[model samples]
Target: MVRSGAGESMRQPVRREERDRGEAAGGGNRSGGLVGWRPRVLEHKVRPADLRAVGEVRRELRQLLSRWREPAGEDLTEIATLLTSELVTNALVHAKGGALVRATVTDRLRVEVRDFAARRPEPRAATADGTSGRGLMLVCSLADAWGVRSHAVGKSVWFELGGGPA
Candidate 1:
């Protein structure tokens, strides 16, 4: 069964004054530090079975990373893109509906792919000659943290990488 725990938190909405201040400072901390700084979020939803849309999603993520005041560096960005691709591809191929991708960036980056399937993914040992079944393995090995969170309708597979507006 999918674990519906961890990585859940209630975040207060950004106040108007805080937002104005953030905007004034280019959406980053005034002293370019994370203290009291709000994270930046980017979200996208892919239609069911639209595998091609994965590329678009990756492109959008890359764009978002680029626009950040302190991008997560090339290595982190690439890792984020690859891991996101894995989650999204899995959701589209194995799940019954589209997936919602949400990315949050602060001093770290967290990416979640939510789908309408209640099933949780299991990592299988990939054969040397086999061409499939390595996504979850990569996620487990690379992400600083990763887990599954079940929603009322489905579940979300998420992973995090540390490195951002520092």
Candidate 2:
């Protein structure tokens, strides 16, 4: 089957479950959203040089949860936001190329940043006077689980908040 058609516009690929939920929630092509899915997934391109993208990622995450009408507590949202900022900021500063932030809400909340950097990130030894090098440490302490995966052209840094099945 072809991915496009006459008078048809190309669209982002979305999971099946997302399509149903988005339609049911009035967030799909039938209404407002182009593709609505529960455990809503959203991604945005980032310029590591721009420090502001971090907050923008966080804000978008908040808006997503709100749109889903998830009963997620503020605490959940806050932690998710903070961790997202750290990961995205790290990617922009270190990834050495364009980055993308993806927020996935399944049974739990997860935020991941993908960058074109091949090196894996590790928490550096922190000294009392150090002003940097604590991002991953915070993720470890707060997230239920977090880790990185290497890609041929880059890597993705991710963290999960709260508990839920995979």
Candidate 3:
């Protein structure tokens, strides 16, 4: 929770309000006379091989939404939770090494799951009675936007849920 440059630690909402009007609104972890602030973030490290990874990520997602200034709704939360579960499960089930889960709150909520696996995610049709292979479908249906990005060490699968008028 420590600020990146300074030694001060930061919690959710990522702001400091002054009792007087002079020092309430600062920029980049400093006290100044600005008006508003944004960019709330939450991150967690995960063990991809562990059985509890998916559920653990979903719980953290819930916790992250709780700190938002204006959350979308329970419906969006449910979809986002399901999306988180899908992406995290994909990392644990298919990817190598551990994973990192990050949730950023802005005009939209962006959830990114990173793992060392290089295999890209592809969607496959699932049968009515077939009880598997529907993760990406659910993500595509529920998320407003989604894509995968490759990095040297691993890849990141991310989805965004818009926080519009709900």
Candidate 4:
């Protein structure tokens, strides 16, 4: 057995015939087990004020989450989409600076929207003439857990949906 540069023993000896065939085929065997096994980390940045960008974010997130082993069928997807839309919309409407949406999938899916606004979001009663003010309510109803965190520069409103079918 010959040792490679990394001091690992080669599993097999290369014969001259095999080498000629490999050279003819323009290929070489890499003596390593699963050389590329990097873990995946998904992170995205977006300006929440741009409605088109927000929609794109949602679409990308849905695609990413759908590939994962989530047990909650459409319920998780619906809740994530609705809450993300509302949070991003609220940030665009109320926050001073733009918002950043970050999504991560572990045992559960967590969506966080950060904006440069010190004021915490509160649900208000919509009047008869009101056309809005129900976003937070919808978020609360759909998400397993939702809340806001205040920071010196801004705040991040985050929500989580547990894994598994609804």
Candidate 5:
């Protein structure tokens, strides 16, 4: 269990059944979410400095999106995959520590990457010739909503895509 800044304990790797009960993924009830309308949650763990885990997590996310009873379409899967890749890569590269990835599906798809680093991520100015430093930029442009939440140990960088499976 992970203790939040609010002193509430959250269990990691919430299962489908657990999520359906409206259990808090981050120390709070689904935030006035609709009754009986629970989210589907999935989790992945990336080892320290394991960039290969990025591709593994992306593949898992693709499988989850594809398994949705309601079609999320290829575009959503791609966008979510891309944003997740960015966040996971950042966590692995910058934090130089392990990361926990969580994906929750409600009316939208929200993915979060939690790392053991206090410093938050910021969008950088990418030059035309730069091959990197555009992760947050893509997230800002592509995600319907995105933000960073401070945790007791570190922070969670998250992004959401609207028009996702209900």
Candidate 6:
């Protein structure tokens, strides 16, 4: 049995022994690790009305993902951060009530910002004057794909990363 640096069993011999016994009974080798499983899911929920709270949420997300895997060559962290900021910003600026921000990482990372607003976000052309209306454009530029989905209460703006699960 190998213990981790933290002094916890890295792999339980009892489980392995049970598997070996089962395999011996059935005529097979049971030396391999757990046969079948899926990656764990990580989730976060935040209220979009509080900008600072949203930023902190984003920061926490970055730290968590960073510990799991090195950021892909693509600027995924930056893209995700920008995408979250833009979606949450839009929710706060345009929606009636506060918004819900949900982030999940599985085979890929997905961020959804939901708000009680039926209004569709318009794609704004950058004007020479340069004052307002470019958040969605930034989101479009950064995300692999993004769009708005309507719910009974309001809508959810969601984006996905191109790489494998975070």
Q: Local distance difference test, per candidate?
A: 0.83, 0.76, 0.77, 0.72, 0.84, 0.68
Candidate 6 lDDT, 55-166, residue by residue in tens: 7767866765674433544377777887788888788878868777777654456678888988888778879788657888888777766777788888888887746311
* lDDT of residue 76 for candidate 4: 76
Q: Write the per-residue lDDT of candidate 3 for residues 61-91, one digit (tens) a residue.
A: 8888877767668888899999988888888
Q: What's the distance in Å from true for residue 121, model 1?
A: 0.7
TM-score of each: 0.75, 0.72, 0.73, 0.68, 0.75, 0.66
Q: Which residue pairs come into collision in candidate 3? A: none
What is the per-residue lDDT of model 5 for residues 17-43, given as tens digits with 9 covering 90 to 100?
Answer: 445456554544543555566668889
Per-residue alpha-carbon lDDT of candidate 4 for residues 56-82, written as tens digits (9 for 90 to 100): 777877787777643447867877888
For model 1, the run of ten residues with the poorest summed lDDT: 11-20
Instruction: For candidate 3, give the lDDT of residue 79.
Output: 90
Which regions of candidate 1 fall more than 4 Å away from where they truly are?
A: 1-37, 163-166
Each prediction's number of clashing residue pairs: 0, 4, 0, 4, 0, 1
List the RMSD of every prediction in angstroms.
Answer: 9.6, 11.3, 12.4, 16.3, 9.7, 15.4
Better of 1 and 3 by lDDT: 1
Segments of candidate 6 deviating more than 4 angstroms = 1-48, 69-74, 164-166
At residue 123, candidate 4 shows an lDDT of: 82
Point out where model 2 deviates above 4 Å. 1-37, 164-166
Assess candidate 5 and give its lDDT: 0.84
Score candidate 6 by lDDT. Answer: 0.68
TM-score of 4: 0.68
